[model samples]
Target: MLWATVDVWPELEQAVLVEASASVRKIGQSLAVGAIAARADWVAGDATIDLDGLGPADLVSAAYVLDEIAPASLPKLVGGLWRLTADTLLVVEPGTPAGWQRILAVRSQLIEAGAHVSAPCPHEAPCPLVPPDWCHFSRRVARSRLHRLAKDADVPWEDEKFIYLAASRQPAPVRAARVIAPPKTGSGKAALKLCQPDGSAGERLLSKRDGEVFKSARRADWGDTLA
Candidate 1:
């Protein structure tokens, strides 16, 4: 296993070393990259941490890091990352509209490079969503005492909106449509917003008369992949 970061932030560097210890302790191989290589001594005890010869990995992930990169450098950075991805590449960003646009751009670039969409999107066709609307999802996050104080929040939890893309070098297994929004239910009926396999996004209203399909709709949650 390997971990890389562009900067040498003390906390971040320490965190990476801590996380990589388990991999090093058990498997006996790990590589440190970029500026973190300068502090190579603090890595796992007795493990030989290589400071050179970086190579492609099976899975590559870039989370919330693109936002720190300059827009003009994005293409080059993404291309470099993709070249390093032996199988899959996962990218994540804040779920704001601007964040979604950045992901969308990356999505296009990956597709153009022959990668296949593996999640959140059922098809490779251009995102069905248009301006004034975009694809995103929310996750419930528990807040620490310090976090609560920082945000001045009354709730112990908050919804973190985020957008992500999982692209693979090979075609992905067939998947069902993804629920793009919270389902609306009332009086034995449900309306679900779906991004379907046919490369379309729309609402589908299901009622008791539809039996199992209706039941599925009622039970569906945002971000679910429904058949």
Candidate 2:
């Protein structure tokens, strides 16, 4: 519940706080939300800021921040974040090859610190993806008139691609393989690129001949889990 940021965006904080307050009021839990918000210490500092003063939280997140960090300082920063994470730590970055590489490096660092990979990967073993290939996902966002004007675009929506890692202090539960690409369906057959729990990744081809599995494959999307 503690929200901290390195940037000094008073307007951003106020807007989000107002929206959250409104949501709480609508749900008739304004008092409860108020108490939590009141207790939260909003600290604004750079990545190198001392975390010792921030205390521990159940969940810690570093979003769009790692890409700004120097390569040599990443380990130290990650170590500090992990230390403050009482349960889980989340890190997010842009969905580019370079961003994925940064996430991969952070994943290894967290694993070395005895953290478990809680998401995006079913296994804690080294990533199966090699150079020239990286793991990322996309979300479609509808653009507003102002947004369209700013970008000078005509498209109603755009894909916001990103990559993230979730690491937990406890071991992660067993999970099914993850789909890494958009499903390709044709001729009553479906092809999916999957990252399996066995620390391997490859394509899975299914046809109507496969029965129920084929039906499931047809409904699956990128980032979904498959058995």
Candidate 3:
């Protein structure tokens, strides 16, 4: 999940990774080595990180390690990490009920801690999808031969669904709306479900000849920002 972000954002090279066990550093190092940009100053360690000694980085990441920790320890952990973020910070967890709860809590805490929403979400406001609903995104992964055999899977591609958050210290981009579902286009009209900045959502229908709006709708996908 994070490797994808590192590939897309050129300025996101320097990274500060914190894990409680610190054993996950091996997996992180493998990804970084596989990356084309190896110039990154990789700083990987346990939870007791020295923010003052190392300073901030372009990216700060805490992966699946967070879900294992105590709920009461979250604020201190996330709050301290927020201050160590320079450009972006990402957190990834499962797509289950527990995962959604963590994401929701972290979302509010990030806003309160003054971090801006970067992706998979359009605004810093509360999430529109209330309980019984959750927001998650999938990254298509190509199945390796060994991977397929281990899982007894035949599909060549798989979508890894996970709840993630990307926040920055900068202001969020100005997006009028964000597409929350795959758009439907037919009969010279387009219909969309959008996530708005006010922490609510609505469906919109536009004619094919509606000019600018129709064009924008045609290009947007399930998780794209609608300008």
Candidate 4:
């Protein structure tokens, strides 16, 4: 049925290979939970373990139960059932250097366990998870051009969102990266800016004075700051 299993871990790279291997072997799936708190949609609901302090043992238990129960699907598991299959198991980590290391570690373990491994090739084959409606400057520009070309060609790519023209046929909205301002001491102010991929900007000010205009201008001037 083309089943895909995923193990989400906070610090996946530092996982103990032997322990992971044992858990995977015992679980009967190429994928096993790493240092994750819970399965994709399956919530343990067990308050015995501290959610803030998850570890390997917790991961193993979660994986074991998830693989054993094998819920209908990921969405179905949203109700707290863990589901998995043997077709494809994805051990995903956070998007950090340490996360990459954990992904590699799991990949190594899978290979050593005689499982086929595939790497994400952004250039050759971009991830399907990346939506075309994403609001990255490059992606937005590419979509704009494609929409123009499609219009000229009398194609059926017309959509208000403009994401229908994306080669991946996915929506890609550039989510603004959040920055936490340092705590104010006396009467200082904190501000946040929302900058779109295009040359548009918006801002929020948290001070007595009306600094919205200033913040917006600052955001536009420092468009490349977050990037």
| C-alpha TM-scores of all predictions | 0.76, 0.80, 0.82, 0.22
Candidate 4 weakest lDDT stretch, 10 residues: 161-170
109-150: candidate 3 lDDT, tens digit per residue: 998877888876777777878667667655688999999999
Q: Which tens-of-lDDT digit does each residue in 1-227 have in candidate 2?
A: 22333233222322111121344445434443553433333344454556666667666788777777788888888888899888989899999999999999989999998999998999988899997988999989899999999999999799989999999999877778889989899989999999999999999999999998889899899988875
Better of 3 and 4 by lDDT: 3
Residue 185, candidate 1: C-alpha displacement in angstroms: 1.4
- Extract clashing residue pairs from model 1: none
Candidate 1, residue 34: the lDDT equals 45
Root-mean-square deviation (CA) per prediction: 8.9, 7.6, 2.9, 19.4
Q: Each candidate: what lDDT?
A: 0.76, 0.78, 0.74, 0.31
Task: Give me the candidate number with maximum TM-score.
Answer: 3
**lDDT by residue (tens digit), candidate 1, 25-131:** 44422344443433433334211123123466566677776786678878876887788778888889998888899999999999999999998899999899997
* For model 2, the run of ten residues with the poorest summed lDDT: 11-20
The whole-model C-alpha lDDT of candidate 4 against the native structure comes to 0.31
Can you rank all candidates by TM-score, best first?
A: 3, 2, 1, 4
Those runs of model 4 whose alpha carbons end farther than 4 Å from true positions after fitting are 1-85, 121-227
